[model samples]
Each structure stands twice: as structure tokens, then as C-alpha cells.
Target chain A: MDVLLVEDDYYLADDTRRVLAAAGANVAGPYARVAESLSRVAQGRVDCGVLDINLGEGPSFIMARALKQRDVPFVFATGYGREVLPDDFNEVELLEKPVDPRLLIDAVARACRKHETSEV
Target chain B: MATLAGAMNGPGADRLSALPWEQTPLGPRAGWPGSLRAAIDLMLGAGAPCALFIGPQLVQMHNLAFDALYRDGSAATRALGRSLKRDDPDSSLAKAAGEVFAGRSILLASQGWTIGASPGTPAFNLSCAPIRDESGQVGAMLVLAFPVTSPARLDAGASISELQHRVRNLLAVVRSLVARSAESSDTVEDLAAHLDGRIAAVARVQGVLLRNPHAGVDLEGMIRDELLTQSADQDRLNLGGPEIVLPPKAADLMTLAIHELATNATKFGALSQASGKLDITWKLDQAGARGQQLELVWMELGVAIASQAPRRQGFGTNLLKRRLPYELSGEADIEFRPGGVVCRIAFPLAPVAAMGSSSVWGVTTTAGDDA
Candidate 1:
């Protein structure tokens, strides 16, 4: 499974990539901004993704919406609670920060599992 | 006015008499109308802070409590018996007084008023009611001024500053966690696991605190939250305890401690296996002098453990034993048994009433609980 990780914090992003890599998922660019991450999501062969809702500039709801349009499964990793998320993304998996490493790995795996099950 | 003779007996009566009323448009007190005299009497008699701007000239007559509003040297003395138009023309009090003079009774709430040359502009909730004479005309305007800003505003400002300070401290804590985790891990994967676990612990604490900002954190709820984050199988974990509210300081420290324990269990302790079991129980030792002391025990069962403890102390051990003790004034005993890890923590609970009455004690699990 190839996972795209979008997070603004460099340290947290690096850590997340490492966790996913260890969990046997092929990790893509750990993009630091919405524009870069959005382009990566468009260009890369991403199976699923882990997204941070707040990208320092604004929310990543647009990214989530874009992924949803492409029928992609993704999980939100945020410091803020679910109340800040849009109504449309309510069914999307949310992982509150600091995300437990086990939970993070499990969520990305689950996202991939859901995608695979749906495709079959 | 009725010769200012017997009327000079109430509060602020001496100040009222001492003022140069003869120099104002209302002229001497001896020649003032009966309505004006009655208004002055009523203003001085009240204990609460209030002022009366009498007649069309809007002359000022306030009580003793109202005097504090004009404590700036000459401003207090200069304001007495003077026309609102003549004294501080740009003030909200002057503007509100003008509206009252136009036969309108206005109640101004939390209105800012800059008194004299003072830089601090305090808020005042004032009501300007038009006092009618015997002929049914708007005779004297009775102005009631109540200081509204000091207590409430001071509290809000303090809370905001405290929140900012806490956020800065939390950020510093995150920075330290990342740096420390990097030092211990050999590979990037190891570093991510360590750093993410610690950061998640801090975030969990923040979530609990943010939910019930006024009240202390719920002990049972916090423990369950930490455990639920590590695994989806709730059947393996048995958490039983009465509702325990911990002070913010204790809650923050305990969250990290519990996280460390849970992380260790998931990796190598009870939760590492399919048939593994975990039991968390806590009770209050209410015999303490100040308040109840909480004794919590986390016992991991049905899993094989290492024969010996680690050679060196890790973050989990340091947080439970050293950090917990230093920060929350508590003690923790973590032992690696042959079966699984057993940890015991004891801390003095702050008085229930002091923890704040307005706090909602609802159990708020993370988003993963539903998943």
C-alpha cells in the first residue's frame, strides 16, 4: 500500500512517514503545504493517505474533498477535535494528535483495507 | 432647593455642600427648586454607587461610592455640580446624558468611559431615567452609574494570559519530546514510534483539559481514553472505578504516565498477545487530612514478560517514577513481573469543591472509540 502523508510540522511528518514505512506501506512525499500535497495526491499512485486538518495557512478540507472526489480513503490526524471538521467529512477517520504510533499505523492500514475491500 | 439645611446629613452630603454650586448655572442651593432638592436628597441617601444629573444644565450630584470613579486628583473635585457639557465633552457619560435630556431614558450596559486624563478606561453600566416634576415635564435626570469592568474583565484577561502561557509550555514540551526521542532511537522508525507516543500522551491530556477547562479531569475517563487509543479490542481491557476528578496538574502528569504504560503493554506487555488481559482499578483513600488520596493500580495479566528489567531507564520509567512524583506530588511503583507489567500510582486528590462546580464530568473518548 502506498500512502501519501500531508503534515505541516516537519518533525511530525518525518515521524509519521517512518511509522508508515515500518508498517510495510510504501510512503510518498511528506509534503509540508496544501499546494504541494495536493499536487502529490493528484500525480502520485496513492492507495490512501494520512492528512492533518490544519496546514498552518488554513484547513485541509479542500484536500479531503479532492481525495473524496477521487474515491480515495484517507484519515485525518489533527490536534483539534472533530468539531472543526466539515459536515461532509464526518464519516472520514480522524486521528487526534499527538497520534499514538500504533493508532497511526493501524489507521493507514485500515484506510488501505477499506479501499481494497471496496474495489473487490 | 430647600435651604441645604437638614439635607446636609446623608452620604456625600459634605462633598455636595463643599462643592462650588453657586458658580454653576443651577446657582446657589438655597434658591434651587423643590424637585432638585428632592433629587439631591435621594442621590445622597443611597449607599450604592449612583449619580444624578439634575435639570437641563445636567449638574452632577453623586453619592460616596460613585466618588471612586473620579479618583484622578482634580477630576473628582472638578466634576462636582458642573454641567456634563462643560466636563469631559467627549465622554460617553456626556453623550448618554444628552440623550436623557431629550426625554429618553437610556440604559447603557458595559459602556466604556474614559474619566479625566487617566489612561485606563473602565466600563460602566448606567441608567439615565428622566425624573418628572409636578407638571408632568422631564425635570431632573436621575443617572445611576455602576462600575462593570474590573472584576469580570480582570478574570477574563488573566485566563487568556494563563492559556497563552500553558500553550507556550506545551510547545516547548513537544520540542523536548522530539529531541529526546531522536537521541534514544537507532532508526527513523524507532524515533517516530517513541516521539509519536509521547506527543499523543500530551495531546490526550490537552484534550481532556480543554473539554472541562474549569473542572479537573475525570480519572476513569482519561485512563480508558489512553487504553482505547492503543487498541480497538475493548473486551481485553477491563476498567472499573468510581468517577474520580483530578486537578489539572495531576491530570496532565497522569495522562503521560498512563500513555507510557499503555504503549509498553501494547508493544511487549499484556496487550501484545491475542489472549492478553488488562485490569485497571482505583479507589479513594479518604482518610487524608486535606482530602482523599487516590490509589490506582494497573495490572496486566495473561502475557509472558521478560525475565529481567531493562539495564537502563527509558522515557516510560522516568515519566512514571520521576516526573509523576516531581510534578503531581505522587508516587508510582512500576515492576516487571514474570507474567506482565504491574504499576501502582497514588496521589492526593484536591478538594472536590475546589476543582470547580461548573465542570461537566462527561466521559469524552477520542474519535477512535467509534471506529
Candidate 2:
């Protein structure tokens, strides 16, 4: 599955993007702003995405809603911790910041497999 | 007493005896303008209550009650009509004056009047001294009464110190914010914008500090540094100007305002395009005491601004209109001429001396040779 990584912090975004690509899934981007990333998702270029809650504004909930309408599953990745998770995302998988590269690979694989089964 | 009579008859002795109070009744009991002899005789009859001498020349005192009132300097007080005004004047005079003025064997109690041998303790309350002359006449007395508690004197120093500390903390916060924001930006354009905005924010806080007439900031060099640092390719940029201290808020806004122009140039204007160069210059003008103005110019070359948004106002527009006016209390004009974008920002120079500081002003020129 191809994943879209969205974060405003450039260094962390670049590092996470490299590690995610190394985990075998094709990675499209780690867009700085939510609006730019949502545009990409609307164009059908992404199968799943990892979202940071704060991309300048309070949270990336708007982009998450856009993905939901397209039936695309995504994971939350943030340095601000699980509390930053939106109230509506009680059931979504969240990967806390400072995450190990190996753990991230497993999480992505698990999320992709779950999406495939849910589709089934 | 025989010597006293001889001195009274001597030359200049009458001058010493006649004081301002001698022209008036020493007390209502004697009716009006009584003779110095009668006043002194009456005072002596009443145990020489409290005597005061109001005259241009030195005072003379011979009363035991007056001498005992002063823990020191009774003879000096007698010589100088006015008590010296320094060195714990309050406590000294308060202890001495209370006994002499009240005609009692108690410690004087003047709460505020300052009286000493020097520029005495300020905010004095009361003063009293025994008056005597060669004739041994004690006429109308001198009493200095004042109120000495000043509210401003109480809190001014502490408030000033607290304000300075807070301003320093704010600058530190601003530096951290700039560092963090710089970390967030991707290209040189984004980094410059972030840094410029952060610098402006700090300047705003400093402006507030400076407007207090307690703190001021250097405007010219600050603007140059913030702008040059914002350039993506720092080595390519050149800077020039003599630094001038500005009113604190002006420093904050002026730097940020000028920096916004530079940021735009690096992203879309002259600095962003290939072969683009930037020259920053400033000068200090003494139009009026209050109209000291700082002039800055951002000149660009070799960058084809036409490739960017030639007309649309994006980040640059917001920075000039919204941030500049709000932060710097100044006006900025940005023009995209045929060759490059030139920006000019001008505003009044606040007096830094009032804040106990000296800020230098001069011209500095820097050019960015970005090949």
C-alpha cells in the first residue's frame, strides 16, 4: 500500500518518510500543510496516510475527514501524544512520536493488512 | 550675662538680634510688636520655652533647653540660622526638634523634615531650633514642617527592575521561537519568513519595553541582521548601515518589516530568481528631536521578479500591511521595477538616552553576490 505522510516539521518529516519507504510501502509525500496533502488524496494518489495533529493550525482533522469520505484508512502520528487524538478518532491506531523505525514498519504493515481485510 | 550686655551694645550685635519674627508679636499676650527685651524676658520667665531665629545671618543660642535638645551641633545650629540638610536629617531633627519645639525634656519628633550638615535625607518632615542673639532676646521662632512620604519613591525602583527582567525573558523567548520556526521552514524562503516574523515579534515586545521610557533597542543593525539571516544563501547577501538605537517597538517592527521585504525577494522577488542580488542600506537623520528617522532601502538586482507573482500580494503584502503597521509604527513601500524589487521603510527615532542608554547611528552597506 502506498502511504501519504503529512507533517509540518521538515526534518522529522524527511526522516520518517525515508524510514516508511524503507518499510516497503510506497510513500507519496510528507506535505507541510493539510490543504496541500488533502488535494493529493483527492486525486487518488494515496492508499493510506499518517497525520500529524498540528500542521500550523490546531489539528489535521480536516484532512482526516477528507480521507474518511474516500474510504481510505490512516494512522495518527504526533509528538503531542495520544491526547492530541481527536474525539472522533477513538478507534484509530496512533503512533506516538520518537517512534522506532522497526516499530513504525510493523505498524504500517498491520494497518495495511487491516485495511485489506476490512475491504474484504 | 555682663558679657551678653556688652555684646548687645557692640557694633553688628543689633543686626544679629533683629530677625523676621522681631517685626511681629512674639505672642498674642504681649499685644503687637513688643520690644526684643520684653519678648526675651517673658520667654525667660516661662523657662524660655522654645526660641527660634529667622534671619539671613547665623543664629545664636544660649538656652540650656535648646542645647540639651541637640545630641550634637547645638553650637553649629546657633551659628547657621538654617540647620544643615543632610545625613539622616529626619531621625536626628525629629528626636531633637520634638523636645525644643514642644518646650519639654523629651526627644524631638519631626517625622519628615530633613535637617543636616549635607544634602540631607530627602522627604523631611519637621525642623526646630532655639533662637538667641547678643541681647539674649529670643523672638519669634523658626519651624520647618513638611510631609515626606512619596509613593513613587516607594515602588519606582522595583517596578523598573522587574520590567527590565521581563523584557530580557521576552527576548529569550523570541530567540527560541525564531530557532523553532526556522527549523520548521523548508527552503531559504520559508526559513527567512519564519525568522523575520519571529524577530519582528521580539521587536514588538521590545518596543513595548522601550515605550516605557525605560528600555530602547537598536533598529538599523537589528533590521540588517534579521534580514541577512533570513536570506537562504546567507553568504550571497551583503549588508551595510550605521546602527541607531530606536524606540523599542520601532526596532521590533522596522526590522521585521524590512525583513519581510527581503524574505519575499528571496522567495519570489529579486533574491529568489537566478543571478539575484540584494543591497541593504540605512542612515540616521536628525529632522527634529522627536523626528529622528531611520531610513532603509532594500535594492535587488539580476533577479527576474516577473517570473514570480508580479502583481498578486501574498506573504509580502500581508507582512507590509498588517505586520509593519502593527509592529513598527511605520510605513513601507515595495516596488517591483524592471530590474528588481526595491523596498523602503522609514519611521521616527525614539530617544534612547532617556532610557539611560546610547545607540549609535550610521550607514552600513552589504551586497549579496549570488551567482
Evaluate all candidate structures by whole-model CA lDDT and list the values in order. Answer: 0.71, 0.53
Cα lDDT tens digits for candidate 1, B1-371: 35534355587788778776778887877777677778777888877667887776777778877766664636766677888767666777778777776789998775455456332334457777888776777877787777664442423333443444445446645975777577667799989988888888888878876765556788888888888899636888888888887766677778877888888888887888886789999998975563567889999888864534656688777766765554445688988888787899987664322121222334321111111
lDDT of 2 at B135: 53
lDDT of 1 by residue, A38-101 (tens): 7887786688879876543224377787788888899998765665566888877888676788
Our tally of clashes for model 2 stands at 36
Candidate 1 lDDT for residue B215: 67
Who wins the lDDT comparison?
1
Give the residue spans of candidate 1 off by over 4 A: A1-120, B1-10, B31-48, B67-78, B98-113, B116-152, B155-164, B207-213, B287-290, B306-311, B350-371
Docking class of 1: incorrect
lDDT of 2 by residue, B107-220 (tens): 333333223322222233334544444455433344433333442232333334334434433443454445455555568886785766656645554545455543346554
When superposed on Cα atoms, how far off is each prediction in RMSD? 17.9, 21.9
Best candidate according to TM-score: 1
